[model samples]
Target: MMENIIRLNFTKGKKTILQGQLNWSNRSADSIVGISGISGSGKTSLLRVLAGLEPEVKHHFRFNNICYSDYQAADKNIGVVFQHAHLFPHINVIENLKLALKAAHHKAKRGQANQVTSHKFELEQVIDGLAISDLLDKSVEQLSGGQKQRVAIARALLCQPCLLFLDEALSAIDKENRLEILTWLKTVNREHQLPMFFISHDSFDLQALADEIISVNDGKLISIQPIELSALSMGGGLNRAILNVQFDHHIQEHHINAYRLIEADSLKPNNGVLIYAKGVKAQSAITRILVACDQVAISTEANFNSSMINHIECKIVSILPLDETNQSVEMSIKGSASQMLYAQLSNYSIQRLDLAIGSRVWALFKLSASIAI
Candidate 1:
C-alpha cells in the first residue's frame, strides 16, 4: 500500500540574502527527496521549518496526515541528521543510539516504564545494522570523522521516523568517505524502505543519493528532475557535475581516439573503468561509444590480438537489471583499488554467461562502440 508522504509548504521571513516566495510539496513517501540551492539560499531555514525545530512562522506542513504546526496535534514523527556528528563527547555510541530510541518512544506516546527491555534490543539491532558493532563501546572522541557520522546516522535511523531529513549531512566528510557513507545510506534506505529528505548544494550528494532533485535558488524552488544515484558514482563528478557514462554498441573501432578517455580519477588505480570525455562536442569521435547496451558483447577473457583496444580484464561485482531489456553492470578492473566501473549491458548477456556473484570477465570495448544513454 502507498504510504502518506509529508507535504511541506512554508516560507521564512525575507532575508536580504535570499528573498523569494517559497512554497513546495513532496508527494513521495518512500523515496529520497532532495532540496538543492546555493549558499544562503534558505535551504537550511526551510529544513528547520519542516522539521518543526523552529516555531511555525506563518506556514503549513503535514506529515502522515497530521498538521505539524497546528496548535492541536502539533507533534509529528521526524528524524534529522545534520552535517556535524553532533554526538555528546561524553556519551558512547550505544548510549547515543539509545537516546534516539528513547526520543522515538516518547514521541510514540509509549509509557517510559514499559518497553524498556524491548527498546534495548531494538537499539542493539540498529547499531548492528549500521555496521557499528565495533564502535558500540567507544566514546565519541575515539571515533574517526566517518565513524562518528555513521553513528549519528545510526542514531537517526533508530528513531524509526517515517521521514528522515539530512542537512548537507556529508559536507564535512572527505570524498572517499562520503562515497562510502552514501552507498551505506542507499543500502539502509533500501533495506528499511525509509524515506529521506536531503538538503545540499553539492551536486555529487544529490547525484549519489537523491532519486529526485529539487533545485532551489534565492529561497525559491526552480525545478525538479529524476536522478539515479548510481549514475552519479559511475564516472560522474565527485564534487562537480555528476556525469553518467555511455558506450555506443553500433560503432566498432580497433584503435582508440584522443577523446576516448576514461575518468581521470577512475584511471588512478582500481577505482574507475567507465570512459567519459568532459566538455566536448556532441560529434566527437568518442561519441561512438554511446551505444545501447544490447549491442555490446561480453567475454570471459580478452580476445588476443583482437582489434578492440578497449578490452580490459574486469571482475563482475554486481548486475542491476534496468527493466526487462537492459542491465547496469558493476565491474572492478585489475589496477583500481577503491573504485568500481559500471557498464550497461543486456539481460540476454547476463543469462548467456549464467553470471553469478564474483564472476571474472573481460569487458570488450570496441573503441568505437558506445552506449546511447
Candidate 2:
C-alpha cells in the first residue's frame, strides 16, 4: 500500500483556484485515480503542479511516507503524458524512445556496459508491448495521430517512473487501439504497483478505469468515491429507450436508444437534428461516442455492402491540411440539418476523388468505431 499527501495552492491574475489541502491514499486499492471536470476547472493545473512544471505558492508532498518539497518531489521518478504527443519532428520513432534512456544514463554516476545493455533490452520489451516494432524507422512526421500517441505512451513507460500522470493521453487514439493500450497499462500497474493519476472528462472512462474517482470543480476537491457498477435507467416521453447495463472489472456494456446530432458548422447555429436513430448498441460504451475525424471515411458514393453502419449525406464545407507533410487533410462537411462532421483523408485520396469545397460526399463509420464517453 502506498500513501500520498498533497497540499498546494496556485493563483493567477486575481483569482485563486486551489486554496487548501488535497490528500490521496491507495492503502488497499488500485493505484490509478481518476480526476474529472470541465475545461478550465483546474484538472490540468493540478497535474502541472504535481509534475513540478508550475511553481507553487506553497506546497508539500509525501510519497511512501517520505517528505519532500515541491521541487524535490519532481525529481522522484515521475512520468507524464501530455495531451499532445510532442514528439521530436526531426527524429525517428526508435530514436525518440531511446532519447530519455540515454539522458538518464549520462546523468548517472556509474554507467556500465551491462547496465546499458539491460536498458536496451527493456526498451525492446516496451516497444513490443506497444506493437510498434515496425514503426521504429518511421519518422515522427510520418506517423498518424493514433501512432504518435502510442509512441508517446511507450516513451513514458520507458522512463520507469514510480508515479505517472496522464492528461487525456488516450484522447487521440481510436477505440480499438485505445483499449489495447489500456489493457497493457493495467497489467503494468498491477505487476509493478505503479501509481497513476488519470485526468479525463469522460464519465464512463472514470467509472471503468478508476478504482477511486476524485471529482474537481472550480479547483476545489468536490468528492472522492469508490466505483460501483449499477444499472441506470433513463426514461423519456417521446422516444422509447432500453439500457442494458453490464459491469465487470474489464468491460462495460451499454445499449441506448438515442438520437445523435452531428454538428455541421462551428460558426453558425444548428436548428435541426441531422440523424436520429431508434436504437443503438455500442460494443463498448465506457468512453464518449466520439469518432475521430481520422477514423471516418468519406466517399462520393455510398456502398451498400460496407460494414459501416452510419452514413450521412453531407456537403464538403472546407478542406484543411493537417500537417506539413501533406499526408492528411481534415475535410469538414455539413449535413442537411446544418450539422457538421469531419473526416481525415490523404491528399492523394482528396485529389483522386476530386473532393473540394461544396462537393457532395457521404461520411461513413461503424458503430464499433465510435468512442463512448
Model 1 over residues 1-373: C-alpha lDDT tens digits? 3333333445434543222333334344456877776777667876676676766444565543445555322244566888787998878888888888777767668532222111122566666655789998999999987788778888877776666789877776777667556656655665565777898666656655676666666766555555533343323233122223333222224232233223324532213344432222333221212322332356876675765445656788877776689777776655554334556666787888777568887766542212211
RMSD, one per candidate, in order: 15.1, 15.6
Q: Candidate 2, residues 1-373: lDDT per residue as tens digits?
A: 5666777777877898654565666544335777776777888887777777776456776655545343333354567888898998888999999986775454343432112111222788778878999999999989988888888888877766666788898888886777667756655665666767888765545544565666677877665554321101101111111111221122224342333342322423233323322234433322223344655787789665676656766777667775553333233334333334567677788889998888888878654422332
10 residues in a row with least lDDT, candidate 1: 112-121
Candidate 1 stretches greater than 4 Å from native: 1-28, 63-74, 110-121, 228-373
lDDT of each: 0.57, 0.60
The C-alpha TM-scores of every prediction are: 0.55, 0.57
